[model samples]
Target: MSQKPAWLTTDGAPWGRGRARLVYDNPWIRVTEHDAVAPTGAAAVYGLVEFKNLALAILPVFDDGTIMLVGQARFPAQDYSWELPEGGGPLGVDPLESARRELREETGLEAAQWLPILEAQLSNSVTDERAIGYLATGLTEVEADPDETELLALARVPFREALDAAMAGHMKDMLTVAMLLRGYHMAREGSLPGALARAMLS
Candidate 1:
């Protein structure tokens, strides 16, 4: 099958990219500053941060209408955060593989069913960080193997309560909030099994 052209994937006229050079480099990211001609024909300078990996977020729902959560202290925010299982996948690797590993490593839960739900450019203006969200169901317990650098707290909460917490500002992680809202939407829109949706909302 033929793939769509790259230019067809973006909206509006594309900026004419000029000379670009690496400003900084790290294992996880690279910063590049470039000269560009904007769509408006004005000269501009763009500083783009390119990620070496794709971000993965997983929302694992059990048969009992509950979801798993992980709490940890984030360095950049310097605050505690409760979020769904999240990790980074090598840019060339399958994100679902990373999601599965993250879920298992953090919560010791594995799911038989995985559904790709959403994709977002986390900060398109300044970064090329892309994230993928997945919905995992039919969960089972396993032994957790957390990353050496991570310290996490785990919880199992009813779907409604989790969503409420996310909406009520108790959970501020962007990926977590987006996943909760998306689940709520899927439940209401009949995308999920009726019984499961009812139980989740209950």
Candidate 2:
């Protein structure tokens, strides 16, 4: 076996945090500024955005290679975006349970099978925002109950079409993009059922 990198075996040197002060706070996030020293021994200032919840995303796929997408106007981007059903789970709650609620609320779909596919840190350099992505299959439809703050549009499209659109820049949500790629990898790697994998890749 190849030897592991020395850095991977232990925590190396860390940035020196001198002083930290909360600059802003809200129910959803908190911003803090820090006086710090970089790993290279350079003096620097750092700002961190701390999230109050964990990010969750769900890719709802039907057995025949179709997937569901949700569209909404995003305030930060100031543009309408099409993405997988996604929302925030309270920090200590089971992410899958929160994902289930988001999928149902946004798309009115529930899955008989669920696979946790990806875990990532979103904008790690500036934020403590982390995300979990799920591949949800064996779908059944029900009435949607979106949150009052959400005005969403739902679409069902071929899985490959959605993946291609994301690749082509039509879909820009990072979580959505990452999950689509992960699903494609799973299908191509035979991690999914043979029929489903064929349907997805086809």
Candidate 3:
């Protein structure tokens, strides 16, 4: 077998004039060039920065008052985390369709209903990427469609308890935490007004 294609690559430029330079390339992820300045002296190349598309995550809250979570191995975090059924945007699938598919594949459950609860962007301050968060409701159990690499399992927790876990830092993903917080606001208002629909776009 041959090596898998690199998502990105960077060749560092020699340091001078309080700046470091690099040429970046990408195939699967978006391609870009980065020339960062240090203000004083050159610093070691941190790594290649990826320009990418919006990610979508589905939060399935079922009628039983439980929210679905998936345990995933996060190499950067160096920990496997518990999060909602969620994933990619590069497949060119409709956002809602992605949400529905992730819900079923990761959780072994499907939603009879779906709701657009919140929209948010993602970044590490230096990199640019956005992730859309969606709230799903009215769910039912079904066979899971794991992709083998996922090794995912579903963990259902009550709404309040999920918040408790989040507050305690168990739910480490910022996108996941943000969506759950948005749901909190919706719950408090007793309704997420249609006005929210317009607000989501901006």
Best by lDDT: 2
Poorest stretch of ten by lDDT in candidate 1: 1-10
Q: What are the clashing pairs of model 2? A: none
TM-score of each: 0.92, 0.94, 0.71
| CA lDDT scores, all candidates in order | 0.91, 0.94, 0.68
Instruction: Please list the residue runs of candidate 2 whose C-alpha ends up more than 4 Å from where it truly belongs after superposition.
Output: 1-12
- For model 2, what is the alpha-carbon lDDT of residue 98? 96
Residue range 1-202, candidate 1, lDDT tens digits: 2499999888987889899999999999999999999999999999999999999999898877899999999999999999999999998887888889989999999999999887888878899899999999989999999999999999999999999998899999888899899899899988988888888888
lDDT by residue (1-202, candidate 2, tens digit) is: 2499988889768989889999999999999999999999999999999999999999888988999999999999899999999999999899989999999989999899998999999999999999999999999989899999999998999999999999999999999999999999899988899999998888
lDDT winner between candidates 1 and 3: 1
**Cand. 1 Cα-lDDT:** 0.91
Full ranking by TM-score: 2, 1, 3
- Model 1 residue 162 lDDT score: 95
Q: What TM-score does model 1 achieve against the real structure?
A: 0.92
Error of 3 at 50 (Å): 4.1
Query: How many steric clashes between backbone atoms does each model show?
Result: 0, 0, 0
- Model 3 has an lDDT value of 0.68
Give the poorly placed runs of model 1, Cα more than 4 Å off: 1-10
